[model samples]
Target chain A: MQMDLVFVGWNHRVASLDLREKLSFTPERAREAMEGLFREKILTEGAVVSTCNRAEIYGLTDLDDSFEALASYFSRFHDVDGSVLRESALSGRGDVTVRHLFRVASGLDSMVLGEAQILGQIRDAHRRATEAGTARTVTHRLFQAALECGKKVRTRTALGTRPTSVPGIALSLVGRIFEEVADCRVLLLGAGETVELTARLLADDGVTRMSFCNRTQEKAAALAAEFGGTVVPWEERIPAFAAADVVLTATGATDPVIPGPEAKRALSKARRRGPLLVLDMAVPRDVDPAVEDVADVYRYDLDAFGELARANAAERQAEVPLAEAIVEESVEKFAAWLASLSMTEVVKQLRFKLEAIRRDELARSEPRLARLDPADREMVERLTEALLNKILHNPTVGLKHGDASQRLELAAAVRTLFKLDGEGRE
Target chain B: MASPSSPGLTNALLGVLALAAYALASVFYTAYLRHPRLKAGRLATGLAVLGAALNFSFLYARSLALKNVPYADLLGSMALFGFFLAGMNLVLEVRHHDRSLGPFLMPVSLLFLLLAFVLPAGGEKRPNLKGAIFAFHVTLNMLSYAAFAVAAALSGLYLVLGKKLKHRSKNVLAGPTARLPSLGYLERAARTSLGVGVVTLAAGLSMGFAWGYHVWRVDHPFWLLDAKIWGAGLTLLFYFVVLVRAHRGAAPVTTARLCIAGFVLVLLSYTAVNLFFSRIHSFT
Candidate 1:
């Protein structure tokens, strides 16, 4: 097998979001890039994966010269210098490469750890490569194994359970205090994408009643209409907070919009009948961090949300060893099957050599048997064939039952003892 | 010639095998939670399967010896229910690749299996028609209970892990636990199980009513005022409420709590009717 594998990519470990944004490839751009790589004759088989956290180029190539060529291709395609691309690139060969791909697919190497979305992302990459006519038997098997490893890890472990995202976190918190979301009311303090996403998450969890109060009333009304929530005027945001059981703030304000005093006043108005979950996803802090100290007000800042996400990411990382063990076991099982192919050739050669020896001996004895009856000669030939069969049976059985290491040792012994090849004597 | 009606040997073997398997599976699952090796998990699953098979054989032999369905007696019913739960757990584990559920599921299975050994094994066989209806009721009820068990476990996990994720904690256990299916999936599962429980309860109750009316006049009945019947009716109502709330899109955590409570009621009804109360249905 020609062992050639290359991973040209950027991820959370090697690059910041700013760098990733510049390097990220849209599906259309990825397709164009793959085609470009093919035109440059840098690789025979290739796939591209682009996600919020990662953008990777996986390919198989034979020429030693092609590695540099492929690295330079990534730089030119992403409008970056060769040195910048090289710093983030990872390359491996043979088993290491196979293991790496399996780990990635299994979510052992994911930014979020155990996220299920990456498996679909990998499948999409493989599908696109096949569509581009770049995926051959080797790449196909490699990708298929990776997908299987991902599935096995998911089913056999608890690594993929629970939401790790900010939106997911906010909804889960709201779920805890309320028996059901239908009875709970929500107040959203922004009209940005983060708030919209959080609203969608909460809606999915059965939080039907909500109020959106943004700096702009039009933006609030528009967002509220999509989710069937009412829009509150910005001036009455604190009073709106009193009506809500949960508050999520993700505004673009330079300072805290919902101060600690305002939060405390709202909490007192509700008479602490229910807790208020506040999610502050703004960079500059939409809600004062001190609001968390208020009784019955659970406020989480961006850092806290990020820590939860990271902690969840770490928990998933812990499962990586177990997931890798499964992948390793699978790879060994597959390699044994591959090794068995060599046994077929060995068996064929042994039979051919044995048959040649039998024929030579028969030829020498032909003149002596010519004087005997035809029936007697036929009996001698049958006896000779049976003796040869008996001798070969034990080795053949051993080869079938044994793994690659055992088979290799046995094959070596057979070749050396029989001197089947003249080079064995040397 | 000796009589062939004794299941002494078969019952003993089954009891031993079931207990051993239950213990082994529980340990393996616990180890799997800690180490999470596929080898350990696969071993646990295999033992569970073997245990189920042995339990099935025991039930068959017992049924043959008694010349009636094995579920007729309290012990036999408990054993049958245990087998059903164990079988369901294995299937779910295999299907979802979720072994975290084992610690929760195996104890329930083992408890039933142990109860099976303690209760009397032989009972008076009812008529064939009544026996068929009895079997139908018990089987469906057991299946519904199994589904509810799963829903309860998933919901419990969701409540804890969901809370941790929300607070943005760094707890490893909270992070690695599989994301509970969207609240929608859990609610749907809970509703479906509740619906099945209700339907099964209705069928069972209706059959009891028909049988009671036949034995007595319209105004007076032999088993009309049985505690088992009332308990079952109440349990059905509980699930009815759960189903309604779920249909209206209840939060998964809330629905899960209801499901857990409903299942607990089911267990109480099943136990009280079979073990403590005497009624026309208590042929055991």
Candidate 2:
């Protein structure tokens, strides 16, 4: 019989976030659920992979209606509505299942395309299933292959190397301007949400010094308090520019807050370790446009950031075909292995059935054979064996090369026609 | 001035092969800039090292042919400049762990090799290159010129990267600028080259002046007033000003532009002044 495995899931594409959250499994919950599946005899082996954006199950099952069994298991486990689960569910069996698991591991199926966290999530899910005695050899093989494919895609593609989000862009921009972010001071012109987010990202990148200035003193003080830094009064922000290596501005100003000549003079007096970087993320602008003409200053307004984000998105999207090709090749290999397993069974059953028939006929004619010479009897036996070997050769060769589905169908046909399964389990 | 004789066939062949090797190395380095995962950077460095060895062997063979030193002529001097540049580039690549600079630096040495092929080799014995003092002056001058070339290349990169950043972040990140280090790093590296240039150029000019006053006083009493000396002196003065003032106070872009201008003056002093207006001395 073919080793039939199945994949079932709801992800960001098919399910609402609320449904996904309800379906999400912690490690303990996933392990308990898989153990319950074994107890119920619903699956031979299974793994539940649960994360913020998706929860998927991979299983090795003998049941013909294993997809429906798994769908009902979600209702029993998470108490989610069965109708909603069935509607949002994505189901694939055999090689389709293998491809689905590989895609998810490779981050092609992630909410954020090509994000790396899913690979680790897949590993953790596999680990929990193994610990719960739910993932045996077949499930283990499938997950190991998925992990390998994920690693290959990450290394071979440029999907995850470039930054796309605003915080990510801010970090990349800082990297481009400063040799070392730790030694530099950042001056925030306003403590609005964008400015606040920029502060947190810069802090994470190892900027030890940050001075916050805002129209609201409490907001500036609050940002400064959270990340160890000083707070400058709003009026003295221009003079504070002299101390900053990177100046981030997102204030609600009608006119330019940092004038071209004044900003130039103030930044000229700035302690020189690197070129001054200014990011004007404000609406009516904070830094003057003329500041871009300054020799030591590197400036990026809001439009530049958006353009860079779009380019990163396009570049990442372009890597999909290449990643999918890897997934396809991996799935084909899995299919071939499953085919080989089925071929082995078919060959064994055919040989056994033929040998049993030959033995029974020989036993019934034993007395008549005894009348012949010993050499004649041996020749008769050899002829029978040679005929059986010749019969099995052609069918075995045909079975060896086809896909898993073809091999499974051919194996089932051989079993039923020959009555190789004595109890008629076929 | 000493006018070295024509190089032997063997020495000329080695020099041409060395130049070809360096040119190929530059192609690999440029490829590395575009596709870093190809790992062509290491191969580029290997080829560059091979070229430097061959170039050295050529210099040695030429010296053996002349039965004295090799750098007494214009061709020999240019070849020495190329060799020093190749060596300096290797050092920079190692220090910065950056392969993008190879495309910028290797072509300069290639140009020097090309110029060496066209210029006449001076006689082995007697003009402005008579003694050990003259060799010392010429070697120092060549080293200084190589340093200026490095500064100019890095400064050119700085200007290009700055222009790229102003126009679009995507353009900067996707293009060749992606392979470059930060603008601050480039500026600092160029500044370091400028410092080395200033020191070496000062020493070379001092040696030239003392040697000139000592040797040319009796024969050409007005040798100090030669167009070559004035051009070299002005080039030195311009670099010295830029190195001291333009770097510390002026904007980095202005500093980079000044550095490029300083290199222009150096080329003029080396090429235009020596070719047209030098009265008592001839390196070629």
Candidate 3:
């Protein structure tokens, strides 16, 4: 018999964000649902991994229809329509389930690709399942193997070394040029959404000196107050450019806000510390294209960001096969362990049969031995028990140590020799 | 006067091996610039270090075979300049942890080494009036030119990258400019080399003039009239102006251009003055 694992899930790749949101579960709800699974005997062991990008259930079960049961359970638990859930849900079993879990844990299956956050989510799901008493022997081992795989993939590869997002790539480029981002002054030319997002990422990178300028004083003030930065008046923005090491412009102006001559004149007064990096994220381009002509000014538009992000993403994607190979290796090891489990059952049954025969022989010979001394009877019993143990030892060792094919052959031989082939309880 | 001699077979063989090592390092460095692989960068630096060591041995062997130091003639002086440039790059790599400069600087030393073989090795014998001072002056002068060579390379990189940014080329953010150290960093590297060149050239020139005055007190004014003397002095004055301008907040582009001009003067002072106009110095 095979130790089958079933997996059912929806992820960003196959399902829309709306669908994932509808299918996602809170930690408390996921734990409660796992406990229900064990109580109802729907699964012997299972874990529910719910993250912003995906929701999946990994279960060890003997039932052939375990995938359908898991999907139905998820739909009911989340109060989502079963038809909609089934439309987007992916199902896998056996080694497929093991490999998927490993990939997810290693962050190969993450939406961002090689992001480290998914590992924490996987660990949380495992802990919750273990606490709810739903994750037993097989799932417990599976998750442990997955966590090890995650660590191995990270330590052995450069997958997570480069940044993959637009803001991340931009900041990384700045890091390459400048010795330190913390010393660089950033000027925000607009209070738009992209500006806000870029500001947050820059602040996270330790760029504390920031100046916000916008046509709307209130909006600029609000943004500046939020980040504890200075708010420059819209009129003084060009002069503010002189003090900035980086300028991020995303204004919705029809004409250029910073022309070549204007920016060059402003930079002439700037401190001669380093080159200035300007990111023109505006669609119409707030900074004049000719502004790049100004000496020591490095300008990049949104398209440049996209190009860099694509390159970084491509590099990360190249490492996916290596991570998948690791997953495959781990799955094979899991399959071997599962095979050994069946061997354990065969060995236990064979030992029990030998012991039962020994006891029966002793019981039948009791009257004949009653005439003998107590010591002689006791010695005869011990001698029969020892003989039985000696007979079972070789077969037990072979079942445990032999390869899969050899172990199966030996199991069948034991059953035939003991006449226990039809005993189906085990 | 001792006759000038070609480098011995062993010296020539070592020179060839060193050149091969540098050529290999240059290939690795170019690949590393594209990929930024740690292994490739390390291998390039390792090969460069090995090449420099072999180059040093080759120079020592040539000097021994010639019965004089290598800085006495054009070919040996060019070889010495190559050694200085390679040593400077190695120092920069170790101190800054930046191998991005290797692809630009390595080719220069390789050119100098190649020139060492192509140029005539024989030169006039010198009178032993001030041997120690002459050796000091020649070595310092060669090192100053090496420093200028480094400055010129940095300035060239600055102008090329600056031009790419000026054109707003789509590949500016993805091409060679993307892999370079910042314009600010390159400018600083250039200014640093320029400053070194100015100081060393000044010291070397003053030492040469003082030694000349000691040798021919009455004819010292004629020494001042020599083209090599004027060329060396003008080269010194040119870099001194650049250094001062850089200190007084000259634009980085202007400073970079000035460094390039200073290196031109360096080339003229060493090559054109020695070859055509200088009556005292012998062609090598």
Best by TM-score: 2
lDDT of 3 by residue, A288-352 (tens): 76766666677888887777667667767888888788878888988766554566666776777
RMSD (CA, Å), each prediction: 10.9, 7.7, 8.8
Q: Which candidate leads the pack in lDDT? A: 2
Model 2 scores a C-alpha lDDT of: 0.82
Residue-level lDDT tens digits of model 2 in A155-271? 987777667777777777777766787777899988888988888888877887999998889998999999888999988987887667888999999999899998778766665
> How well docked is model 1, in DockQ terms?
0.10
Residue pairs in collision within model 2: B1-B127, B1-B128, B2-B127, B3-B122, B3-B123, B4-B122, B4-B123
Query: Whole-model lDDT, candidate 1?
Result: 0.70
Stretches of candidate 1 exceeding 4 Å from the true structure: A1-249, A254-279, A283-301, A316-426, B1-7, B18-53, B87-102, B120-176, B179-183, B215-223, B245-255, B272-284
What is the Cα-based lDDT of residue B46 in candidate 2? 92
**Candidate ranking (lDDT, best to worst):** 2, 3, 1
Clashing pairs in 3: none
TM-score of 3: 0.79
Per-model C-alpha lDDT, please?
0.70, 0.82, 0.79
Candidate 3 residue A373 Cα shift, in angstroms, is: 33
* B1-284 per-residue lDDT for model 1 (tens digits): 11122357757677668878987888887777666678988988888888788878878877876777776666666777778778877876776566766766787788888877765544454554246655676666666666666666656665565465455456523623432333333444446656766776677667656555665454445465777777777877877787777666454556777777777777788776656784655635
* DockQ values per model: 0.10, 0.42, 0.19
